[model samples]
Target chain A: MAICTGCSLLCEDIVASFENGSLKHAKNLCRKGHGHFQAAFTERTRPMIDGEQVTIDKAVERAAEILKSAKSPLLYGWSNCTEEAQSEGIALAEKLGATAEATIACTTSFCEGILMERVLSGKIETCTLDDVRNYADTSIFWGSDPSSSHPRHLSRFSYYPRGEKRQRSYEEERTCIAVDVRRSPTAQLCSNYYFRLPPGGDLPFMEAILAVLDGKIPKVADKKKMIELATVLKKTEWGAIFPGPGLIYSLQDKMELFEQLLARLNEITPFKVVPMVADCNARGFNELLFEKTGHASSVSFNGGSAAYGPEHSVLAAAKKCDAVLAIGSDPLSELPIGTARALAHQPIIAIDPRRSLTTDAAKVVIPSALIGLEAGGTAVRMDGVKIKFEPVMNSELLTDEQILARIMEAV
Target chain B: MVSAMEIYMLLPKTNCKKCGVATCMAFAVGLLGRQKKVDECTPLIEEKKYEAKLKKLREVMAPIEKASETGLIIHPEKCFGCGNCVVACPVNVAAEPTRTAVGLGPEGEKVILRVEDGVVVVNNLKECKRFGPSGTLCNACTATCPSKAIEFV
Candidate 1:
């Protein structure tokens, strides 16, 4: 049994088979997971320095030398690494007096506002996916398309299954509402209940919901639909709002509107918020960093003090830092083209299991065993639940934790 | 594998709204979903001119039931690669005690369905529990498919 690290869902029940140095068969894998598992065989990176094949020890020494000489070295891409590796990375950042941020810092301020402000502060009501399946009747996908993202979301927890309390399930008891910028696959599934918002329209749309909840006509287009949505919210026995990057990116700094909305909904009935985190262990990195430092992401341990703000963000750090260590994430592929170009100019130390743009451009490429497949470690689900798994395959490659520890030792 | 145009060709082509749908195309879609029957088309059934067409229509649609009884058919066009079917299978969870109850495959290395190119595909048909006579007729995937892309037939 293997856990899929393709996404933050961290789907635990995976049966994977390997034969002749290739993934022969795998069960319970989404397309993303399938791609991730297949990546082990295709484009597998070797220890390299300046496009030249090097031994692992030589690569580690080069990576350490690069970080050691740099005054403002940036430690990034912790979201895809194990919790153990993240902790080690944080310690390394502290020792090196470097700025550390995860890939989550590149987009979606969700970790900073929601995870740090509300969840860590205990200001918002939250529950696990299990609680959602068993009790949630109204599953609101706010600017989220779980169909394309967290694939098993509806079937396993949000809508489909007949839970202990939700015996009727999606047939009669459950109501799925999608609020998005366009008619996404999830919105199409919601059918009549879909609410199409304009780009950067989440704030006003949330205001409309709040207005309707207060028994007032919303100051937006389609007043009737807003009223109907309000009516549904009023009648909801148990509801959960799964906010994706769409909403988070839209709300940005004014995420308090979401908080106010959740507060208002909870006053009438039970409501919870579960962020639709992208990476498999993004939340784990945030939680671990939060445990060590107060901030969820974008923190710098420099001059014996933890400093956090936009200054420490990856986008900002990309310009200021001379050296970077990107582990388990490919910023070159996912980030904006300009940002990718900027990071490409820096001396990058990329540690990954598979080949990617970041690894391809790195000055030193150190291949590590994949977590949940070739290596076993702990990962936090999107909901902040800790899940541990054992590696499915035996590998000679070092785990991320071991690799990071070696780098730290060499530095 | 039958096209909507092929099903529409077998229709009376009368553009008759007696089937309660907008057009013959809509009726063809209904036929695919098993919501409307060929006999419901009064013109096709009563008119002798359409006798052979109706017979061919029935023959073409005959496999729907047997297919539903034997295996699950996933319409890739409707699928958005939502891992609903992958997670909803009991075989997936039962194969390993730690795994979730709803997911793709279990027992050995046979995968029933996999998402390819952002759409779901029946990668291994025989691996599904509903493939054989001793099949449990588990409709968890079909029941949970948000897009109704999966059908047991």
Candidate 2:
């Protein structure tokens, strides 16, 4: 059995068969994970510098040379790498006196980062996916679609699977609700409970839930529906709200409203919040960074200390950093045009298994082994549960942990 | 599975009732619902020219043949172990009760559909609501599946 580093679920029960240096068969792989497992065959990146193929030694030396020469280097994209790699990466950042941050920092500014801080600090209650499966009755997918992102989430934890408490009744025992701007696949599963909101409707919707909880009529036209929804929340024995980009993006700075809603729900019954983060090791990085620093997502290590601020984030650091060491992330394609353009012009050292836009434009490229498949390490699940994995296959390429350690030595 | 129009495109479209169906459209629905067999289409199967179409139709309809006593067929390749079917199955719910209302694995206990090794596998077929003469056509599992991985023929 092997773990799949496809998404934050990091599904641990994967059974794969290899034949003659190729994946022959794999069990328990979702469509996303199936594609991820097949990544061993495609776009295998090699050591490259200045768009020219070079030896691994030369590539590592070049990467070190670029980082060593820079006054301010930003190490970005750790969410796709393992926790072991992230540890070595943070060490390397401290050594170089560089600003290192997770790739998720791009979204952490306005996305899950704020809620993550609350969750990590225990200000707002949080429960594991296992806890969700065992106890949660009212699962509210607020601005998140586990169907498209984490395909196995509903089956593995949230809505599906006959849990200890949910076995007594039929479908209505576990109520799945979705409040999103559009009808996502998850919303379709929620069916009648799916309350379609406009782009910036989360605040008002949350207010409506609070209003209904207060036993007062809501301002919305569908007051009866709101009352019904509130009654479900009030009657919930244990409820879990899975917030996605939609909620965070919409809520933005007014995250207090969401917190207020959670508090309100808790006043009536137990309610927990789990941010629907997408990256495989996003929670690992978030947990690690919080352990080392007071902050959760992004931080900078300049002048020999870990300092976190808005400027320390990847999107913000791109404009300031003279050099970049992007490992397991593709900022060029994934980031905004302006930020991607900024990072594109700098000296970039990309450590990736497969060729990507970041590697293509990188000043130095050192391909590392794919996590869980070619290499193995630990990663925190979306709900902060730590999952350890062993390598299921062998590869000549070094792991990201080994690569970062080499870079640290070179620096 | 694809729509009837897609299945119809692969059919002979001759409106010929050689398969004991009225029109090719009805035959397409029959094939989708596993009421008609692809091999029963004499033009698609008997002719050398329709071999590719025959093969494609066979590939498409192959999963339906894997359906159990309840007409519930789960495509293992499409399943990511999202236990919609396992939890939605009334058999599992009716079997186990209390002990805090959740976190009960349907593997050896309540339900016929269990998610093992990242995909759903059927167990205890006899207890399934869709099993036996008293069984009704219950489809909570199939209906709740987001990927359409679960199908009842």
The pairs that clash in candidate 1 are B67-B153, B68-B152, B68-B153, B86-B103, B86-B104, B87-B102, B87-B103, B88-B102, B88-B103
| lDDT, candidate 1, A1-411, per-residue tens | 788888888977666788998888765576667777887788889999999999999999999999888877777787888889888888888888743322223122324344444675577777899899889999999878987888778766887665768766665888999989888777866787999888889999988899999999899979998998999999999999898877877656786777888889999999988888888888887777777777776677777788777777777878877888888678888778887898899999999988999999999999999888888889999887899988888899999899889988877
The model with the greatest DockQ is 2
- Give TM-scores of the second chain, every candidate: 0.52, 0.77
Give all TM-scores, in the order shown: 0.81, 0.84
Please identify model 1 stretches exceeding 4 Å from their true place. A98-117, B1-72, B76-148, B151-153
Q: What is the C-alpha lDDT of each candidate?
A: 0.77, 0.80
lDDT of 2 by residue, B1-153 (tens): 577788888887888899998899999999876677787899888889988888888887776766776777778777756666665667666665331124234424545766554567777888877777798978877788776778777
- After TM-score superposition, what is the CA distance of residue A72 in candidate 1 from its true location, in Å? 0.6
Total clashes in model 1, counting residue pairs 3 or more apart in sequence or in different chains: 9
Candidate 2, A108-221: lDDT as tens digits: 544677778888988889999988887888899988999889987886788766566765333657889998888887898888898989889888888888888888788898
Model 1 chain A poorest 10 in a row by lDDT: A101-110
